[model samples]
Target: MNERSPVRICILALPETSASVVYGMYDMFMSAGRDWGLIVEGTPGRAPIAPLVVSRHGGAFIAGNNVRITADAPLDACDDADVVCVPELLVPPGEPLAGRFDDEIACLRRCHAKGKILATACSGAILLAEAGLLDGLDATTHWAYCDFMSRQYPSIRVRAHRALVASGDGERLIMAGGGTSWLDLALYLIARLAGIETAMQTARINLVDWHDVGQQPFARLARTRQAEDAVIARCQSWIAEHYAQPSPVGAMMQMSGLPERSFKRRFQQATGMSPLAYVHTLRLEEAKQMLETDRQPIEAIANEVGYEDAGFFSRLFRRKVSLTPAQYRRRFGAMRDAIGCISETR
Candidate 1:
C-alpha cells in the first residue's frame, strides 16, 4: 500500500452475520500493508486499509451463533469508505427476505452507484442480488444458495462451480464461495486496492491456500432435510437405513403405501427431488464417507452402497460429485491425514 492515505473499507454488518467472517475481514484488511512490516522489521508500518463494521442501524447485536457484535458506525454515515463488504449472512436458501434488510439493500445500491467496490463473503451475495446491483453480471454465492439464487433471480448468471467471482459494471462486484474462501476474497481485495506484492505477503503470513477445486465437489446433489409430508418423511428415514439394499426406491415406495405415480409425485413435491434421485443422494453420500475414511476395494464399496456395476458407479459419482471415486478418496484421505498430522504437531 504505497498510497498516501489508507484505503477506507466499510463492512456492512447484518442480522445473523457470522462473527468470524466480519472480524476476520476486518483483521486481514487492517493487516494489509501493515502486519508484514511489523513481522519483518522492528518498526510497524501504518495500516494501509482502514476497516470499519457498519450496520443499517449502528449498535450492538447478537450474531447467528449467539456471539455479540458491535458495529463501528451506521450505514448512512459510511459514505467515505472506498470498499463496502457484506460478510457471510447465516441465511438459509429458499427462505424469503422480502421485507427485511430494506435499508441495507438500498445503501448497497447507493454505494455501488457511487463507484464503491462492493464485495461479499459467502451468502452475503444474496443482498447484492436483492439490490439488483448484480443484474446482467456473473455472480456466485455459497454452493447451497446457487440454485436458489438462480431460480429466484434469473437475470444474474450464477456460476456455481467457481469459489470466487468478480463481475458487474466495471467488475466492481465481487463474491467468495462458502466458509473461509473469504480469505481468498480478502487477499484479492488487498491485491486490487493495495498491491499484488502486499497480497502475496499477506497470504504467506496467514498461510492461506486457494480453494482451487471450487464448490461443486463440496455440494451435495440432493437435499437431506426431512420433508413436511409424514409419508415422505417415513420413506426418507427408511431409505437412510436401507439405501444399500437392492431396489431401495421400490422398498421406500412400498413402505410409503402409495401407488407408484402418487408416491413419485408426492415424494417430488415433498423433497424437491424424485424418489430415485433421493436414493442416489443417500447412497453417494455414504460412499463419500467410506472413500474418505477406508481403504476398501472400490467394487466392494460400490456394492455396499447399492451400486452393483463399478463402472456405472464411477460414472455416476463423477457426474454427481464432480470427482471420480478414486480421486475423491485420494483427495479427502490426504486431507484427513494432513489435518491429523497438523493436530499432532500442535
Candidate 2:
C-alpha cells in the first residue's frame, strides 16, 4: 500500500475577522490543490480530500458568501490540521488582544505541539506571540504593528522589513506581514506542499502577482523608501550607479554639488540616514547578492563591494547581520543553490 499522504488545512476565525484574509487563503488553497492534481478526490484513485474550517465560537460565520459554515469542532480541530491559519483579527487602537485570549493561546499550543504548520496574518500575529509560539523566532506582522509587537513581546525577533517570516525548521511556523499578505502566505504554503505550477495557476486565476515568500510586502518597501527627499533620491540614484565605489558623505556632497552642511541636513531629512550609512546599507544588500550568486573569495567580494579590506568587510557584515560573511553565505546561499537546482530540474 502507498504511504498515507497527510494534507489538511484549518482556519481559525475570530469575531470581526478580515474577510479578504480568510477567503483569500481559502481560494488559494482550493485553486492550487485542483491545479496540482493534489485535490485528493480529484486524482485517479486517491482518498477523498477533507478540508475543515472552524470558528472560535463554534457556530455559523456569515463569511459574506451567503454561505454559512458550521464549525463542528472547537480548537481541537487544529490538532488534526496539517496547516492552521489564523486570520487577521479586528484590533482596536491601543488594545492588546480582545477577549477569548486564553482559548486562542491553548489552541495555538496544541497545534504547535502536533508539529502542524501555523500561519498568521496581520494582527493575528499578536495571538501567536501571546501564545508564546513566536518567542526567539524570526517573525513579522503588519508594519504598523511592529513597534507594538516589539514592545509586547521582546523575546520575538520581529522583522518589520520583510513581508513574511518562517523560522522554525521546515517552516512550520510562519507569520505574514500586512493584511493582504495572507494571499502570498497561503499560495506559498500551497507551492511548498503541492507544487509551484499549482501556485502559478492559482495566481493567474486570482489575478495576483504570486510573489515568492521572500518578496517583501509593499508596505515594508514603502517604509524603506519613505525617507526619499529630493537630496535622498539623488543620493540613492548615485548610490545605485556607483554602488561598487567608496560612498563617503563628502564624495556624495561633491557629486551632488551641494555644500557639506546643507547636503547632510537635506539627505538626513529625506532618507532618515546619513549618506555613508545609506551607502553601507546598499553595499550590504549587494554583498548579500554576491554571496548568493558568486563563488568569489571573501576578499574579492569585499573589493567588489568597494571595501578594500576583507577583514573590514567581515566586520561590517557581522555588524549589519549578526553573522559573518561566510556564515550568511552558508545559510542563504544554500537556499539560492536549492532554488537553482529546482529550476534546473523543472
Cand. 2 TM to true fold: 0.56
* Backbone clash total, candidate 1: 0
Q: What TM-score does prediction 1 earn?
A: 0.82
Tens digits of lDDT, candidate 2, 241-270: 687765466677887788888888888666
Residue clash pairs of candidate 2: 227-270
Winning candidate number (TM-score)? 1
- Candidate models: Cα lDDT each: 0.87, 0.71
Candidate 1 lDDT over residue span 1-346, tens digit each: 4557788899988777988889999999988878888899966777788899998789998887898889999997668888999988787787899988888888888898899899999999999999988888899999888867887888999988889999977789999988888998999999999889989888888998878777767876444667889999988878888988999888888898899999999998777568898888788988988898889999999999999899999999888777899989999988998999999998
Per-residue error (Å), model 1, residue 169: 2.0
Any idea what lDDT model 1 has?
A: 0.87
Clash pairs for candidate 1: none
